[model samples]
Target: MFLTNVLNESDCQPIKKSYDQWYTFMDKNVEFWLPDSELHTKNHCARVLLLALLIGHQKGLSHEEKDTLGMAAAFHDSRRLNDGVDKGHGIRAAEYYKDFCREHELPYDVQTYYITSYHDQDDSFGLSEITNSPVVRERGVLLYKIFKDADALDRFRLGPNALNVNMLRTEEAHRLVDFAKDLLQKSNETNS
Candidate 1:
């Protein structure tokens, strides 16, 4: 209700959630593929999840929608084979999410599955794939874009020039540029 009103009325204010707050919430609900890897682990996922929620809020996403982002963030990279360009890692992660849901008897969210399945893929294919899924057809594009931008925001660990501001999908994501950098700095994470 508040998010709906906020979106209808005016721009949403930016929010900064404590990194430690999010980091400590990492429950290892689903074990990461490279748990010990400095590149892809709970820490990286925490940062991406934080960015996704913050971006979702700035975009006035409903609580349910933000929850979807959280789900995506939690399992998107859990099946990675390595730190390098793991071509099908996203799909593997998506399958893992699906299997986990089935095993746990939890409601599966298709949108999160799609977002996880395509997170490592090119934007063109990712966007196209989302359009074909009626489950998320209404807002899948926006959600996918937000997830991508959130993941990209953490690219600061890749190097200084890893993230391009112009490439960001949403204005809110663009606005969080400096915050992303600062968060990455405080986290002391660097991709190898």
Candidate 2:
């Protein structure tokens, strides 16, 4: 509701454009590839993308950075097979992203690749743990943080294991937890 209201009322064309493009891309190239998993769906990706853009913008990231984060959010679960403890879904998603970008001839950044590759890694749940990696630090630690929190914000789909506000790394993400959960619940109700 918050995202919809903001996008509906705001004149941020680039964010709106990126948002629309992501949906189109998902519908055209990714949705059909999804399995029967309930947690990793177009709806989940939409929430993650919205959260990423919201938190990334709050961090005052550049337009390019926001775009990369959006892309990462869109593709983060593209390779998910089941909702169970799929430890390496991020890695699989990254590989799928590489192939998707290559086949579509889309321009991509290494930072986005790293963010997508490790978004699901539990180590990424905290800023300190994520920054311990020199590669992510040098490339895009903030990007990774935003992506991770954005992904985490959607954990309401996990029911009892839903994301807690305290677990969100970014302050902005923490603030959005309630709204995200509300949206998630509404989505669930509608789906049910």
Candidate 3:
């Protein structure tokens, strides 16, 4: 899948450079992942990054927050072995995240690692009960929510039943769900 150019110029600018680097990395490392999985490709990562940026921007997060989310988005699934609910891929990806950061001398904090590692485990979609839980509230909650929502928004790629807008965590994410769906539809049509 190719990266979608659906975002506005302002929204795309910050992520463009990172995505450019990610695209090259993905092309080089394509053989490390499941090539045909709708849910775990570099294109999905790009979409997630876009979604994370939109949500973070809507919530008035800092540039650092957005950039961290971008990093989590890009490497969230870098270590996936298969598409069938591989339970520990997040941990593996987190490990790869560390290596990637160190190898490229990129800056990252522990929170970014937590966000990437836990992104797949919680699909709370921002339910107050879950969001209020100690685990989520402890650290990186905002970025975690943004990452989770960004990843969930892409569930449209998994088909209609896969996405539940109400399950989305933030108001902005709920509002953008349909648009995400539209992007998936358009992407499919293009690929078709």
Ranking by TM-score: 1, 2, 3
Ranking under lDDT, best-scoring first?
Answer: 1, 2, 3
lDDT of 1: 0.79
Name the 10 consecutive residues with the lowest summed lDDT in model 2: 1-10
Q: Count the backbone clashes (under 3 Å) in each candidate.
A: 0, 0, 2
- Model 1 over residues 28-101: C-alpha lDDT tens digits? 36788698887787778877987898888878888777877888888888898989998999999899989998
Q: Is candidate 1 or candidate 2 better by TM-score?
A: 1
- Candidate 2 error regions (>4 Å): 1-6, 9-14, 31-33, 124-139, 189-192
TM-score of each: 0.85, 0.82, 0.78
What candidate 3 gets wrong by more than 4 Å, as runs, is: 1-4, 8-32, 123-139, 190-192
Of 1 and 3, the candidate ahead on lDDT is 1
Kindly list the per-residue Cα lDDT of model 2 for residues 1-192, writing each as its tens digit. 324544553533446767777656765787425656677887788878877887877788888888888778778888876777777788788888888889889885667777887877775353454466565645388788788888888887788566677777888888887778776776666566
lDDT of each: 0.79, 0.74, 0.72
Candidate whose TM-score is highest: 1
lDDT of 3 at 34: 67
